[model samples]
Target: MTRMSSFRMSAWGWLAFALVPLIPLPSVAEGAAAAPVLQGETCSVPGLMDQIRRGLASKSPAYQRYLRALLREAAVTLPGAELQAAFERETDPVMAEHLAAALVARSEREADREAMQVVAKRALEDRDPAVRSATVRAMRRTGALEKTGDLYERLMRDASPEVRMEAATNLVEDNKFVYAGQHGPATDTAVAAAAASSDPKATAKILGTLNTEKLGAEAAGTLQGLLRSDSAEVRRSAALALGGVPAEQMGTAREALVSLYRGERDTGVRKALVQGIAQLGFASAVPELQRLKGIDPGMAPEIDAWIRALETGLQEWELILREKQRLQQAP
Candidate 1:
């Protein structure tokens, strides 16, 4: 129902939307809910597990009641294993709103990637769109978005419109910090500093931003340097950034990329670099790609696709651009 083709806010527009004042909700008092009769008879993990074990044994409402209390209190995280076990045993179908939400909420607060991943997997396969939507929002709240990006992207095409919309919103909002840049020396310095200090993967996100005269040159130069970085993530980002650079730099960019790919060893980075070549490199790079494919027959299929993409894609792009220019001149 949710269409991935729906108009998305630009990076700056997303930023502006984010600038709205948010009202902070009141925190739950720890003593708001009486501690469940857990092991050690308290709110600790062992205590919670004891309660869970007892409840699971009896298949009673005690464990479920304990979980509901934990959800209401919102101060502590239930162990993922115990929480999941409780979720599976819930006779009532409200676990999506209660148990799964608790799991994701606690995981987001704890920065627990494993627990978050559990929710992500569930969201993708969950029968209920509401559950899937909540899980997508939780993914947006975690620092684990970089690792779980593929999963989120897959969810953007979810059959449920609500789930797809949630996934799409998160994808746009999550990348705001990276793509929201204007052409200026200050922007250049900020980007350079971020690239140097932050995780290469984070810098990689910025590489996908649209380029301008000043930023394009700076980014092109920075990307070339990153292409040879020790971190494959940096190299991968640099390769992907190839498509957005100024026209004048494409020739040299492709040449340098081809040279880098010749000696590249990381399979993932190699694929990224090949994709980069398809974006910016010319037919001249094909022989080397074919030669490399022969050297690594395992990659022959991938290389053939890249060669086809390079041959076909750019020609089509050129025609499109020419048509656009002609239309502009016609007026």
Candidate 2:
């Protein structure tokens, strides 16, 4: 019986040993295999171009978007000929626009003046309004419009309001050739059209450009008219722009802003008025700023701060003017 029991135990042990391979065991270092890493030739320019070509040929919209992103990333690093070739081969207007945008982006990033001029000229002829608008912006960024003045004038008259606005903005900010004696009717007309656009954003952009270019006196009449606009945003932008008006035009700008402030109900417009007043250092406005600070609870702290700053600024300005007068009379 003892021998039989021992034999039975040995048989059971053998069966357990045989089943060990069939049962799943906890993963061990030596038993696990590492996943293979993917290797591709995406690092080289030619390889990227190949990818772009393939992506453009694909029917998937997602692939096209990916290609656009890749092109943007490559920018001026890609050969100009390659980009132009791609643009030429592209049949879809939208795809062509994307390719054009990539070229423009490259031009802007590298400050490639020649490339920008070429793209601008081509973009102006493009059937796509978006492409034309983008090219106008690129011209503005690269200051290429300064050289291509006719393009600016032509773009200002574009059928699309968006394109016209872009052209107007570029003309105002980038047209360095339109100097003191040469400010022509074309520029005046473009500015007027931009300021008169139904799109307040476009109008606001023009006003802001006027301020940035320090051409306030040139647009004094437009600024005055804009201050009376029903759109509070237009009025606010006009108020801020008043700060940049030429010294000869400050009085007119100040009067318009103060008059608008008196009847203005919007807190935002009122704040803009304070800023303009502060910019002008109009000491006489202290009383009105104080009054507004008392009544407008939403921006009381801001108004109060402006009041203090204006007071200090006006005092300093007065002292400088008095000293200058005293020195001039010392002869």
Candidate 3:
């Protein structure tokens, strides 16, 4: 047998190939056969966003609105009145309130008055702390943040501890201004050092400190050295740390990533490479990704999706560049 066929015949390989192509292969049975699919909205699967959208847009009122809001946010909006009712029936006050706001955003025109009335009702009276929290979020989304500020303040002082906590968290989160100096110059200095530090461990520690712009220039400069780290742990950390590195450095990082992918046989390192590539969103890595496809076809869909998104982005960049050149020449 060929290498691919040989690999496919291994225990894990047999299991991987024996299962359904579209649906996930069954997990290894330890004792009894799995339970029958007598399901009504089972969340056992990982990628149920599409399934939930379809189910929610149906006759189940309570489930419909809840599913709609969830699906809508995922870029797969469900339709119908059931979703609206589902939003209302949500026991979690915060969630109900969120559904209320989400509905308002999705709805349109004076024709949606009746639906708006339901949202308004939830905003007015929902005992669940989560419902109340969702209501505040909805109001803000509707540009009624100022109008709802008084209500949010009341929630902050609510009798329910959950309500108070949600209110406080949202208050801090929505404002953004409050978190300004929480980590200032010292944090920035540490991040700068980590990005350029010669010691891989030191670099990893510094990279860990930064949540933002710490990855750009320093990541580009450190790319070659990081890929050559003597310590596997440091190399793995460096790979992860390169996530969110500047787009301009994507080409350079791509080479290091491929090297890491090949040289580092560790599963953790492989996963890190996958995640970092996803973060960098680089198109130049398409050829490399295509090469990796031969090694593991199971991840083909994800790899293809990444390649498409990157290529589309690169195409748009090219168009922008062309337009810039056109403008520059016109003068």
Model 3 spans > 4 angstroms off: 1-188, 191-209, 212-219, 282-287, 295-331
Can you give the TM-score per candidate against the true fold? Answer: 0.39, 0.51, 0.31
Assess candidate 2 and give its TM-score to the true structure.
0.51
Instruction: Compare the candidates by lDDT and give the number of the best one.
Output: 2
- Total residue pair clashes for candidate 1: 3
Q: Per-residue error at 148 for model 1, in Å? A: 31
Predicted model with the maximum TM-score: 2
Q: Rate the local accuracy (lDDT) of all candidates.
A: 0.56, 0.61, 0.50
lDDT leaderboard ranking: 2, 1, 3
Candidate 2: where is the Cα deviation over 4 Å? 1-125, 147-193, 206-210, 282-302, 312-331
Between prediction 1 and prediction 3, which has the larger lDDT?
1
Cα RMSD (Å) per model? 17.4, 19.5, 22.6
Comparing 1 with 2 on lDDT, the higher-scoring candidate is 2
